[model samples]
Target: MLIDPHLLAVFTVTTIVALVTPGPDMLFVLGCGVRGGARAGLLATVGVITGDALYIAAAAGGLAVLLTAFPVVFTALRIVGGAYLIYLGVQMIRNRKKGQTDDPAAGGMSGRRAFLNGMVSSMANPQTFTFMVAFLPQFIDPAAGPIWLQFLVLGAILIVLEFVADGTVGVLAGRIGGWLRARQAVRRRIDAATGSVFIALGIRLAAER
Candidate 1:
């Protein structure tokens, strides 16, 4: 077997719990859904999945360890990623204030832009790389047929779990957005709130070691 049955079961449970727990990824999806509608949120989820996939591959390929060995690179990623998030948040805030467009706050993004934004959010997410480096390996059994294969399997499982969990969040958040869209006062407040959340998330990510 590429992985031990017992270990695989435990990994599944642990990963489910991890994905269920509200993290940056989940929150990001929720915010996107609230702002961009269900489709936008799902696209963001896909982008996040893509980023996580890359990180998983990197972790399996020893990039995680190499990153650990070189603190400079990791630190650089943290700073850059954090800054990027902050930039996105600020732009959202500015766009809302400009009052120049008839588009809904969530309506402004095209699928391509949303997907790209999601990709950026996920890829640059400090937690993305760190989680891959810190987690998953613990379940790896050196005796397994091949470590890379095991990692790949585990990574696939994680992606599936995250999609289900985050997808639900996106869908539900879209509902909330639709409801809020009907009430101008509520919609305005929600728009501002979403932007604030993004800023807060960005700052939190930036400060995390």
Candidate 2:
């Protein structure tokens, strides 16, 4: 709560950049919005926020150290996360080529499923936990107050930014869905592009040290 202006600025900028980046989180939300609607996207956003909060809390409590201490755990998480990304990417591509708007299967993706998908996608990424552990403390001033308080404040800001960004994307998708729906070819191309991005992210994650 006793935040320095300089540190606040750093956290704000870092959070904005991270929010803007197209990752599994963004892609998942985007896909949800495109396929389901704003409600589905919002549900997924909530799921992502929940997962992010958990990671932030864990990092703040120094839980990341235990996870990182075991190289095998980190490696296994990387593989699982990478494979999940690939699976999501393929699904997006397949949906892109589909013609039905009210497909029972697509409709069957309940809000709970969307939320769980968001949570599991982010939670499975070891990099997210490590990033939080390393990125948060740099802005905390031990002289001020309890480190946990600082973590809570910073984590709240991060979640708020993510919600805003993802919600905006959801709204935009709703507005654009009409036009996108009319053009099958364009939709297919977008699907291919989405798949490529996910695949690239997966490969990068898998190759990471």
Q: What are the TM-scores, per candidate, against the unseen true structure?
A: 0.90, 0.78
Highest-lDDT candidate: 1
lDDT of 1 by residue, 128-195 (tens): 77678777888888886788887899999999988898889987997788677555566666667777
**Which is the leading candidate under TM-score?**
1
Stretches of candidate 1 off by over 4 Å are 97-107
Q: Which stretches of candidate 2 lie over 4 Å from their true place?
A: 91-109, 182-200
Clash pairs, candidate 2, are none
What lDDT tens digits, residue by residue, belong to model 2 across residues 1-209?
49998889988998899889877677767766665556667887888789889988877787777877876886887778778777877777776656545432332235786687677667766556766888888888989998889988998998999999987886576456535644556556656765676666666666667
Give lDDT for model 2. 0.73
Supply the global lDDT for candidate 1: 0.77
The true-versus-predicted C-alpha distance at residue 66 of model 2, in Å, is 0.8
